[model samples]
Target: MITITTADAIIHTLESPEAIADIPSPNTRAALQAAYDAGHWELYEPPQAEPEPLPPDWPAFRLALLQSASFRLWSEALPATWREDLKLAAIAANAEALQSIYTHCTTLHSPGHTAATEWQQVADHHRIPITF
Candidate 1:
């Protein structure tokens, strides 16, 4: 099992401005700052993007979230950027691996070989690491 032992720490580290500097767009910055300032946030819903397919354990993970008040509250309070990041991460992950990554956010670990790796399995794929 690919477990992320310190997901909150990893979220904080990845959420740093310096970490996501290459995402582009001033809107992203404003949105992220607003979420931070308010101490509450929601996922971004851009028209062009869509949620990825879930893996085997997705239902279990979702059930866990629904069953846990803490996770529900925290997830509800997540910033838009974080939501978008989650979506992107989902897009970059395998259908069978989505639940582990999403539910294990607090653990901070990412899949070793995922959609991103598969998409970028060639020299030409380097044009954009940010594109899902």
Candidate 2:
């Protein structure tokens, strides 16, 4: 299970600029600050999704991370920037992504190499690692 522990920590520090000032990821901290500056740092209950929908914008999506750190982010709050260095660490996270990864794990556990490869292919087909 890929337990994204950092997301929760990021949300906790949202209220206090000084609190999130020093965390593991500098970009995460900056995103939180941007959210605070934009006045959308407060948490919110993510919309219930049958299969988890991806947010339209990645930067906005990154800021909306909550205590539970749901995959969905407030796309409207994202800043307008095209910086190549700007990337979202959790953009690939969602129920569908989890399920796909889980399926790959299960296939690997079953000792079915070919099936596991297929599942792995499906999982890797769209997921792009964030580079910062």
Candidate 3:
């Protein structure tokens, strides 16, 4: 079994026939040619794909989101009743309330929305699943 590097080199040399002369070993060249003729170039094992990353730490994310300046500002800007309701929902860890908040922030183009978007992008880039 050849290493991945050797397999790649073989494939490259086969594809570029002129490069075959550069290969010092006659046996290696013959093997490469035979493999190519047999359409077995891909018979060599491929590199393993990277594993999918685990989801972000939900509790930590929630805490950070709740404590964010954007969230604070959004809450402060709400009417008295709505503000109280939002606080209660947050305390209760209501999923619907969180979704509602996200929707509202997005609709209003609030700073909270920007913060959420940034956080989401960062999470995606790090291969972390974003629950929110």
Q: What lDDT does the true structure give each of the candidates?
A: 0.41, 0.40, 0.55
Candidate 3 Cα outliers beyond 4 Å, as residue runs:
3-46, 79-101, 105-109, 112-132
**Model 3 residue 28 lDDT?**
77
Which candidate leads in TM-score?
Answer: 3
Query: After superposition on all CA atoms, what RMSD does each candidate show versus the true structure?
Result: 26.9, 25.1, 9.3
Best by lDDT: 3
Question: Number of backbone collisions per candidate, in order?
Answer: 4, 0, 0
Residue pairs with colliding backbones in model 1 are 4-107, 7-106, 7-107, 55-95
TM-score of model 2 vs. true structure: 0.22
Report lDDT (Cα) of residue 29, candidate 1: 47
Residue 88 local lDDT, model 2: 25
Regions of model 2 farther than 4 Å from truth: 1-15, 43-132
Clashing pairs in 2: none
Candidate 3: 10-residue stretch with minimal lDDT: 1-10
State the lDDT of candidate 2 residue by residue for 24-127, as single tens digits: 78887666666666565554445576986443443343443331121212221233231111222235555444345434433333424554454334334434
Candidate 1 off by > 4 Å: 1-56, 87-132
Candidate 1, residues 1-132, lDDT tens digits: the string is 111112132222233434334446676545544444555433333358667844334334334435555444555565665655665644553433444445454344332344334433321232222221
lDDT of 3 by residue, 1-132 (tens): 232123445444233544455678997766666655555544345589999867445456556656667666665776666666655655565657755765564454455447667656544554444333
